[model samples]
Target: MPWWSWILIWVALVALSLLLYVFLGIRLFRQFMATLKDLGAAGKKMGHISPLEQAQTRPEAGRPLPGSAVFASPTVMRHDYEASKSSRREQRRLKRVQRKTDRGQPQALGDLDFT
Candidate 1:
């Protein structure tokens, strides 16, 4: 009702909003720092763990798990071969289209200088 009372209410609201923002910003920064620390430790631990994993297994494990290779070989040998040929054709078509597109576009700065 009073003008002073309204001014006080406005001041209180602004203070509260600023406090909330500062609190949230500090909390978020702390969380981000904590996540970075955790990720660093995890990366370090993974490096150690990966070497331990490799050492724990026999060297032959890298070759094959018995007859599993017989089944896997045909899939690898045939599956991608036809797909690779098709992809080669596709790449040639894409290169032709790209050459045409490049002819129409302005050259970049890097293209003008080589060193």
Candidate 2:
């Protein structure tokens, strides 16, 4: 009814809202901590399987494990190296061509201007 009474009611509402926010925040924080603990426990359980165990385990029912090459010859490595080097060189050439095109540069004599 009065101005002082309205101010008092507003203050009470603000205080109650703040208290509710604090309570909800604390509860959410506790839940988040519990979730983190559960995640840590799950991680620990997962960590029990070592890298060797994973490598030994068959991923498929019938297929062999991947990257289990028994013999890697020098010729095979040299071929792979040459292939990768050629691919990189091709990529660099393509990037250079793209940059020239982006800058409106001509690639051939027909594209040159004599004016």
75: Cα error in model 2, Å: 24
Superposing all C-alpha atoms, what RMSD in Å does each candidate have to the true structure? Answer: 18.3, 13.0
Which predicted model would earn the best lDDT? 2
Please, what is the TM-score per model?
0.44, 0.48
Per-residue lDDT value at 81 in model 1: 65
Clashes of each: 0, 0
Q: In model 2, what lDDT does residue 100 have?
A: 77
Tens-digit lDDT string for candidate 2 (1-115): 8899999999999999999999999999999999999999999999998899987776886333466333667787677668879888868777777777999887655333356
Q: Give candidate 2's TM-score.
A: 0.48
Candidate 1 root-mean-square deviation in Å: 18.3
